[model samples]
Target: MPVDSLPNSILAHMLAINNVPPPPLRSLPRLRLSKTINYGQLNALCHIRGLKSDQHSSLRLEAHDAFIKQYPQIYLHEKTVLPKVPHLADKRKSAVRLAEKKHQPAMPHNISAYLREARGGPSIDEEEITEEKFQEFLNILKKLPVYRTKHEHNMVWKILKNIPALTSQLSKEDLKILSKKVMSETWIKASTVTGDDGLYVLLTGQARRRIKVFRSLIEENDSIITSLYRDSFLFDAELKDSTVAQLYVPSKKLTVKKWGVFGSLKGGHEMNESDRSVVTDYDCEILKIPAKEYEKLELEKVKHENAKKLKLIRKCPFYETWPTLSIWELVSISKFKTFPPGHVLVESGTVISFVGYISSGYCNIYRNIVGLVDLPINKVKKMKKRVYMGKLKEKESFGEVSILLQAPFTCTIITGREVEMAVIEDKDIQGKCMNVI
Candidate 1:
């Protein structure tokens, strides 16, 4: 029979009636304790075993009583007489020695052994993660602490790249740099305000806007608490495009909070200390980038490109009569691209991708003309071949007529040397217009 099933009276009766094998050692839970990580887990495990969430035996007598109850058999020694002692007189005297048995429960001498047993002994089992849990496991990989700084940056960059709100505005290279400058953190206790004048992403767990509450209301469970989720982007969550970055799939059991950013944008994305504070409902993992630093970083990317593109866009004679506002719009659409010598910019009878303005070098125009084949081994035969035409020089534009009329280019154009051009592509980028012209 299991020791836990034994009744106090029956166990006593059995011990009194029969001889049994040596008493076995067992563990029982002790008092509840204020935790410390792995120590806390052990304490919680004790509580699950009907122990008081601690490993400590507060009173010596309590463990003694528990030990005796669990033990299958216990023994008491019989009293005995001692050997006779020599007397100073003629007679020797017999002495009696009293037998006394004191019971004491055995404790662990090796701390490591005791802890191992407590943690569940060495038949180490590894559980398999099922298909249903793959996503949750993937979320675990996103944790920054698991990887080194550079690796973590790359992981974050991958996530940022997928987010349409950032992708639509910033280049992949810009987002990569942004990922490196950001910081990630975790909070398990309710304390400080969230969104420290920065943008944030809650990677895991739940949290809520901590508002004021009375003790009575809390005790009665009548006070309402606003809950939050693993929102991929907060703090400027609503971008200039008016789209909120989303991550967590909404559970039918929970509703999303109507609040946009966790804090006010005016406060540089910081929660107002007087009335607003975001606290973890349990444990939370978050990534953040300071607002001021983010702006500075973005400006560096903008200024580097803007300085060059501004000059190139001004070279367009079509914009000579256009306003500065319209010129900047052109700058927004323009992308600086370079091509190696012999690279084809356009082909006759094919759609042109971009309206290009030559910034450096030139392009050789060609026409498909029916002419004799030029091969030494073969007799001359009439075939369609590329016939060299004139060249398009620096500051010259192409694809304007084709794009305006929505038709294919009339001639083929190939780069003469390593050529650079400021171009506006004629394509649909998720329905966003690329060329203002």
Candidate 2:
């Protein structure tokens, strides 16, 4: 019988019954073995027949008594232990002692060995997990402390659980709903209220892909998530275009929270927070124009382009104090550019390298003000992009301030709608327009 197979109490009695060899002389408790038996002989006997110490004897009876008292309606089986301690040298005693302190008892140390003696050990079987049991396990995990917050670890698990490759048995609509839930509450930005433009653009793409892949994984769970998470996806997962990677199979599970880390490693493009400034609402001085005054400035600049013929610059309350230049002369003095709807024109902190003048088309200016605007003001207020005479706009210019002051671009400029504007370069404006300044 294996040493562990015998009950410790029964093994003790059996050892007493046999003329068993004693423990090693140096390590032995008070008793010494007769010279008739050597350490080798004692070891051989203990290998064939098991022995137990007082602590083990008491533990065995306690386990039995507790089992019997609780499970009177159920039958209890005989206990067994395997004698498989590997021999190690004494110099490792410190490490071995530490490990012994942390050791946990195993029920069947080896399933194969226990199966061979199934008629003897504890009554539990070597059970195979079923689909239902897997789901039950998942439910239990959902209730664990780890699942409460929207952490990357927890999000990954939620992704795996909610997706269909593992749960095709679930409904299509159910999977769609799960995908929706993932997006609505998953990874959120931890930085400024106005997102970094670079990060915002990248995240916009990521959010779209996460939603799509999450949908596809569930739709074709059997062939998709399994292949990707368990097989080939690792090689492709780090793409900044997460949507592309998500479309491909996972081969292995993704555990990282920050998607960019994976994207950079995979040779995907990275956008720095500096690049992401487009998302922020730039702080700009507002230039509100009366309808008639704005209309007159638009007519002269757009129609004649003759700075000398421009009456508005000479007559207007806003532009009168401003240094004067002729209409055609102003065109020569400034550079011109145009933007259509949805175009990002200027960014914050960028050198207000040049001042702009709106010749035509409506324009709007904005700054990031939290608890104020939900969407971009142009979108929410339905405002057209306009040139601010007092505030910065198409005909209105800014970079001159920096050139005059020799500072960086103080504010960002973005197009609210398509409009044509002139950029008055510092040299033309300072050398010529400032001839009047």
My TM-score estimates for the predictions, one after another, are 0.35, 0.23
lDDT of each: 0.54, 0.39
> Stretches of candidate 2 above 4 Å error?
1-303, 307-318, 322-331, 368-399
Error of 2 at 293 (Å): 36
Which window of 10 residues has the lowest lDDT sum in candidate 2?
Answer: 257-266
lDDT of 2 by residue, 165-239 (tens): 223323443333332222211233321111211111121112112212422323454555564455322222334
Error of 1 at 225 (Å): 12
Backbone atom clashes (below 3 Å) for every candidate: 0, 52
Off by over 4 Å in 1: 1-190, 199-289, 316-326, 338-342, 360-362, 374-380, 406-408, 416-420, 427-437
On residues 114-159, what C-alpha lDDT tens digit does candidate 1 reach at each position? 5543532221111332444534434534554335456545655665
> What lDDT would candidate 1 get against the real structure?
0.54
